[model samples]
Target: MPLFEDLPRDIQLAAMENAARTTLANRYGITPGAFTLQQYEDNCVYRIETDTGPHTVRMSVRDGRPPHHQASELAWLDSLARAHTVTAPRPLTTTDGTFITETIVEGLGPSTVAIFEWVPGHAEPPFREPGIAEGMGTVTAQLHHHAQTTALPDNFARPTWDAADILDRGYALTHPDHPLLGANGAAVLRAVAERIHARGPIPERDRGLIHGDLHRENMLLTPNGSIAVIDFDDCGLGAYTLDIATVLSSIHRLCRNDSEAYADFAHRFLTAYEKIRPLPESMDRFEDFLLLRDAFIVNFVTSSTNTEVATWGPRRVAGLIAQMQAHLAGDTYPGTLTS
Candidate 1:
């Protein structure tokens, strides 16, 4: 079955109209002609040409599960725009001003659709330049600062980061017969969970609204040398340190080959961030945060029963489990930024 055919008809229509309005007749003064869909590792993005130029429309899928927090996600985006924090895709509204249109497709479950003005740019490749690192750091700091003040909706689900939450999910992923399950996975997960629990909850001073996922891929570099951050789907209220950890982990993943170059980049990024929002006094726990981040990814990837996940999840989970064991056993963790 074709991917989109599973989306409800109304949602499909809304998506098409959103593509038309945002890219063409609304501000660009031209109509869109033919549209083509680009499937990424995570979402289905469509590119259409308008009289003004070409624009892209993104639609997120749940893989096999139901839509995850569609209403709350849109609400958070609206709140961010209202607060005037940073430039985010304002939900393209209909004549009636509703953010999403729902529809029921035959084979697929209910789906909600929304649109936004496409921001154009390319992802900075790994180890490009130290200047890029500074740019990323400055923007991330600004984003965290803005997020700190925004009031999120009541139902905004926080990122699953609590020690118990991590352990519970970790066990679920490592259940016997699961391909990703390993002898050391459960033990490593327990150790991390216990360490976090013993440290106690993060004090309110270190907790705030954060872009739970702030990797380089989520940022776009425009022709004018400006950077635009996109994809607030993972935005939530969490430890500010976790946000920093996410960025650091992503940099390490992308620049694994050129440690010296990425180390320079990481230093520049962190320096810029410290200038804006200084790292918490508890920043000494950053190594723990990094371990938590890696373990969380391992659990998520392994728990997913989706075929797309099965191919790579097991191996990656095993690798992370081994690394965590080594760390716990006094081996220095490998990465650009060490404790």
Candidate 2:
């Protein structure tokens, strides 16, 4: 009986799988035939096999959001599904008709678990691929459109992802201070955050529910040529441009070696997004949001307690800081086009 963190990798996974199975049987009444761990870093994500089909079960060990936040995510997903907008993963309730289950793992303490009917699709091609970036744009706009017209339920709750939340008060940079970033890197991050704050308030019309982590990996390409968005764990109230910047910054990092390809991808994405909804106002400050996206990643990586993930934190934070420094110096942020 070792503490969860002290257990060997395989042993920890076995314990998690067992916990998932037990939870599924007791809560959902679906005894799974197979269970596979899909992600092990920030959260424990599993692919469970059932007679009907596959479904995904997520175990949130450190989730601190209120119950309303989880409810808010499922509500939006249901709305998008019914609206026939972009395909969103539909959540399943427990046998008790509750959306969330409070449970404890053998080694770990309390955790929040939920299940989603497995989204039917595969990962999309690289952003450099033609039409791929455009598809991301179209799907993002579809979500924004739904958010704009729909009325939020009175009980709905979510975080507001603004410059201060993501950057100025980032978990890694400020929570006892990240060792790798030190003082200078922290200053660089604060400088960018200040510029974003100085841009003034976001228009009422420009703020809405957004997929705060809508990068390439969160998207899937279905058989019928539709883009399916997954992982609503980070959904929140934010400026629409923040979502756009998330997508653009992902492409920029992936295509860092090829400026031409990055430009092509950015052009295609923005052009297609405008076709759906007018680009969020104040896009001149779009690059600022892009830097914010990088800061978000830095916080995510450095805050992880997982040893494997923490091992990569330094290098990852370093790379992200380099990009931020370039933006701070007024040099063209990579993959950003002035035209």
Highest-lDDT candidate: 2
lDDT of 1 by residue, 1-339 (tens): 656544554565455545444433543344666666643334445666755555555554445222445455666667657766455665556455555554443344444455566677776534375367777787787787776766666666545554455565554444634556566567667776777678877777887776767766777776666666777666655677877777778888776788886678778888988888887655667777777678667766765544556677777888888888888788766562652
TM-score of each: 0.79, 0.94
Candidate 2: where is the Cα deviation over 4 Å?
A: none
Expressed as tens digits, the lDDT of each residue in 1-339 for candidate 2 is 767788888887787777888888899998998887788876789888999899999887554566668878888887887898889888888998877786777788777788888998887456766678788889999899999999998988998888788886678658636687866777888788788788887787888999999887888988777788999988999888888888877777777898787888888988989899999885877777777778888888777778778777888889888878887887876555666
* Cα RMSD to the true fold for all candidates: 5.0, 1.7
The whole-model lDDT of each prediction reads 0.64, 0.82
TM-score of 2: 0.94
Error of 2 at 189 (Å): 1.5
In model 2, what are the clashing residue pairs, if there are any?
Answer: none
Winning candidate number (TM-score): 2
